[model samples]
Target: MRAEPESAPYARLGGEDAVRKLVNRFYDLMESEAQWQTPLRAIHPQDLSESKEKLFLFLSGWLGGPDLYVQRFGHPRLRARHGAFPVDDRARDQWMACMLQAMREVEMAPELYVHLRDAFQRTADFMRNR
Candidate 1:
């Protein structure tokens, strides 16, 4: 268990191990799930290794754990990094579906899941360029 209070999303999430599990599950679903085979999976690289690591790092910081992403890559520059991708409603929805399912599969607490879901929704909405 993490030293952070249980109320901390990172601690409630079981710290680094849980975060890794969530990221892996999210990418696995995107790769294997038929529903995400279009724009969502298509937007990703043929090799998901880099993509998975980036997300794991980003989520680690975003969820209030160590800021590994920023430490290693500097500021996330989220919009700038994702600007090249053609993100639309369909792609956003597909991403959300996979993430929501991954969270559930990882057995995240309902309250924390809802909180992260809302946060992710806003982020995904902003990612939409069309």
Candidate 2:
């Protein structure tokens, strides 16, 4: 039998455990990092538990592991969902900063690091309302 080809980004990213760590770190950075905490963290609920889970579910499917978010909540409608908040350039940049720090903390591969940084930038930029 042929050796299996590399799996999706999720597996390459170390699956649920790694993804959970990344998400938690992402939130932790948002809550603790001085540069991003004010604008970005201010947008989140005072408590981050639910926000953390939602991002985890979203990223799980986004990374091609499981479609938990869609399965549980239907289409993400991410922008619509986020529309209630003001997501200007400052917000997007702050979010990217937090994610980049989290990615580094997780020690992701170089290629995947660049890929996620760019992808996250695009997604975060697209979320901008201003």
Candidate 3:
């Protein structure tokens, strides 16, 4: 029923709607699973509303959709942006676990899930500052 071009991860993943869902699910786990994710969650504001919007916008561009994040906020110097957070090895692993849980809950396709898991793991690790 859809006519999206091949190879666009954004489209393949169901566009903005799916991306938003993924972001929401990721944050939900991060909030709900506080026992293990406390350190990572602490880096965020008490209210996650802004964080959700930011993640949605960033992912929209990162996934090959319209460049909403760059258009609105300029280049995503991700490392620089995240430098304030104390992301050590534990934080990276916990973040990856939260993301994997989110992807599974959102029922991502097997191939896409694997691809995203690997990519997210690398990205999460890259954010480690300690």
How would you encode candidate 3's per-residue C-alpha lDDT over 1-130 as one tens digit per residue? 2344657788878888999999999899998986655688888899999999999999887877878889899999999999888888888888888888888987657898888888888888788998
Query: 1 or 2: which has the higher TM-score?
Result: 1
Off by over 4 Å in 1: 1-5
For all candidates in order, the CA lDDT equals 0.91, 0.88, 0.85
RMSD, every candidate, angstroms: 2.1, 3.3, 2.8
- Per-candidate TM vs. native? 0.94, 0.93, 0.92
Candidate 1 structure quality by residue, lDDT tens digits, 21-75? 9999999889888989999998889999999999999998888888889999999
Top-scoring candidate (lDDT) = 1
Better of 2 and 3 by TM-score: 2
Prediction-by-prediction clash tally: 0, 0, 0
Off by more than 4 A, model 2: 1-5
TM-score, prediction 3: 0.92
Worst 10 residues of 1 by lDDT: 1-10
Point out where model 3 deviates above 4 Å. Answer: 1-4
State the lDDT at 59 in candidate 2.
97
The residue-level lDDT of candidate 1 at 68 comes to 88
